[model samples]
Target: MPRMRSSSVIPHLLREQANAVQLYLQYKGYHWNVAGPLFRELHLLFDEHATTVFETIDALAERQRMLGAAAAYTLEDIRLASTIPHERGLPRTTQEMLERLIAAHHVIIEGMHEGFKSAESDQDPGSADLFARFVQAHEKMEWFLRELASEPPPTSEVTGRSSLAREKGVPAAAIPSSHAAPPFAGPPLT
Candidate 1:
């Protein structure tokens, strides 16, 4: 049996586990329902994400057990504690799936941040570390989904601007210049 220190961590752990489970289910739903030109890629990616989330569910539950808290194990427990909204019907388009996933990632990230604060407040470094890991994972997943929905960085416009700038004798280095100074021959400064 794990040693008991405080009760405050239990609620956060329960909520985190529930959220992880709900997100895992949502990813599985997307894996099954995703369709369109990107079907193969999306299908494999969603399945991989679902598996990753399933592993996270186990980790969160085990952490709760380590903290001497009872893990939430039932669908009802997840439904009640999770803020992730489940779709009753499957999304019809790749875009719809991506949008839904982006939303879910944001929800999970917020929950993780809140869990991190709660754990830190309770002085539980282990729990806080777990929550930080959750935050990083969700943020990376969110970036992946966002990339699917994103316009291709307006590549045409960017290339056009650079080409035009070059035509006008602006060096390529100056076209998308950062804070670094331009190369120039000058008298040595003291």
Candidate 2:
């Protein structure tokens, strides 16, 4: 195996570390603040994404340490170096939050591609593998979020509608108006 040149990869590692930190923080923030019709789904998605990003952060920092370079130790360090900007405030809606997440993942995925190439050219197969894994994970997360946001607006001119009810050999209008979550049979209001 060829040796890794720390000089050629440490900066890339540091940038990835910073981006991970930023993404983790952003996911947690969205997880806490998410609301509305898709609140439960978005909240859970954010939490899962936060955990994944936190793991990536640890892996990246460890990579830096293994490379004999100091990893970022503070949000200040991350903020200064990260390409993803911190959220200014809570997003106005779940769609906005999903859009924001997709954007952040885009930045990270682009950086991961860059880092992977650098690592490969530097003859560091381990670092290249790590970058590839993160890229895959980020791509999955981006796809899920984008799918959630891809649904057409309720009022849009959608023709030839196809839905679960239609597939069940029932007309769309024949479907119940409210599938109100099994009447929330958990507990009674005080």
Candidate 3:
């Protein structure tokens, strides 16, 4: 095996660590603010996922230490390194929160793939393994969110027409709807 270079692998670890911190904070926010029919389930799930993500931070930082670099810890350092998008404010609906979480997971998973490749090419099997394991956790969390968001096709109760009718180019008159689709609701106030 080729000798490992900290320069080749530490950047990947730093980015992953930053992402983990951001994701963990986002999960905590959702866990605290989520309110709806599935409140209990979503609340608990968010908290559980947050805890899992939080636990990985230490391992990530320690990996950087083993590679002879100080781990990123300050908010400014994390903010600059993190790729996760910041949430504007509290999500108006639980569904929106799930969507945001799913997107965050996607970002993390994408970064992890790159990190894993870099580590593998640099002959750092330990970091590569770490990336692989963490990406799997993110994937599992995304799966849960996707499953929760899935629902049967949306059909208007009065017209008995599926929502996709419009997209499919079916004549609107053929459906004979008395009601228009609900107007777009804007973001909630802080």
TM-score of each candidate? 0.76, 0.78, 0.78
TM-score, candidate 3, is: 0.78
The lDDT values for all models are: 0.73, 0.77, 0.80
User: In model 3, what lDDT does residue 122 have?
Assistant: 79
Model 1 superposed RMSD (Cα): 10.1
In model 2, the Cα lDDT at residue 75 comes to 68
Candidate 3 local distance difference test against the native:
0.80
Report the C-alpha displacement of residue 155, candidate 3, in angstroms. Answer: 9.1
lDDT, candidate 2, residue 24?
Answer: 91
Clash pairs detected, candidate 1: none
lDDT tens per residue, model 2, 76-182? 88888899767898776666777788999999899999999998898788889999999999999999888776643343122222243334332233234352123
Candidate 3, residues 1-190, lDDT tens digits: the string is 3333445888889998999999999999999988755678888999999999999999999899888888889999999999989878987767678878899999999999999999889778899999999999999999988877654345435234335334433323223344445445669879
